[model samples]
Target: FAGIGDPERFFRSLRAGGIDVARTRPFADHHMFSREEIAALAADALREQLTLVTTEKDLARLRGSEGVPDDIVPFAVELEFDEPAKLRQLISDHLYKARERRFNTR
Candidate 1:
């Protein structure tokens, strides 16, 4: 969800299609932030008491360095189908199961 355009619209579309999104962030495209910028972003996250995250694609572009924190997670969004219902259901199920597995292990 990070480093993409129109994340609000994207979330709205997801909601319209019956998908529930707890949180979202849309960082600038190709956002190669400096150390200070990374610290600022992390500080913002700390202030909100929310985890900082970005897209895996954006991470790839960043050479795995800069202001991004070690705790920052990269959200990978994949489009498997053009059909709306099937796509949403598929993604929702996958992420739900994934999250359950993640927390259950903890």
Candidate 2:
């Protein structure tokens, strides 16, 4: 189950990680799942003997919500850049220019 901006991307990531996704339930980005909905998902997973996995963002949203299964796992992903130094320099330059503009405006 996934409630994110690009659930298909998440599914793809799972597949890339060699996880065999037998089924999926996707909701709109940032969808606020109701207790009943969570319960239903839990029931389905339990009945199917499948594990529940979701993205970290969705896990944060569902955190502290009642009926959330204890075994539900949150998948965390990291971004790898081909040119780390170049990306860092670009970001630094952008931030420096933005700061200069802000001060100039002030």
Candidate 3:
């Protein structure tokens, strides 16, 4: 299950990692999972004998919810930039300009 802006991307990542996804349940980006919804998902996984997996973002949202099963797994991903130095420089330039503008305003 995934509740993210691009659930397909998450699913694709799982497939790329060689995980055989038996099923999926996607929700709107940042959709808060209610206890009942969690229960239903749990029931489905139990019935199918499959594990529950979700993205880190979704796990953050489910943190405080009651009856959240301990077996639920959170999938974490890291971004790999093709040009790390260029990307770092771009971010540095953007931050410098934003800081300059903020200081100039004062």
Top TM-score prediction, candidate number: 2
Query: Which wins on lDDT, candidate 1 or candidate 3?
Result: 3
Stretches of candidate 1 exceeding 4 Å from the true structure: 5-25, 82-106
Q: Roughly what TM-score does model 3 have, to 2 decimal places?
A: 0.88
**Candidate 1 per-residue lDDT over residues 1-106, each given as its tens digit:** 4555655655565556565555665666666567776787778778878766565666666556755577876655665666889978999999999999999998
Q: Between 1 and 2, whose TM-score is larger?
A: 2
Candidate 2 regions with alpha-carbon error over 4 angstroms: none
Cα RMSD (Å) between model 1 and the true structure?
14.3
Candidate 1 — which pairs collide?
A: 3-27, 38-67
- Clash count, candidate 2: 0
My TM-score estimates for the predictions, one after another, are: 0.52, 0.89, 0.88
TM-score of 2: 0.89
What tens digits encode model 3's per-residue C-alpha lDDT throughout 1-106?
A: 9999999999999999888999989899989899999999999999999999999989888987899998999988999999999999999999999999999999
lDDT of each: 0.67, 0.92, 0.93
Q: Model 3: residues >4 Å from true position, as ranges?
A: 100-106
Mind giving the per-residue lDDT tens digits that candidate 2 earns over 77-104? Answer: 8999999999999999999999999999
lDDT of 2: 0.92
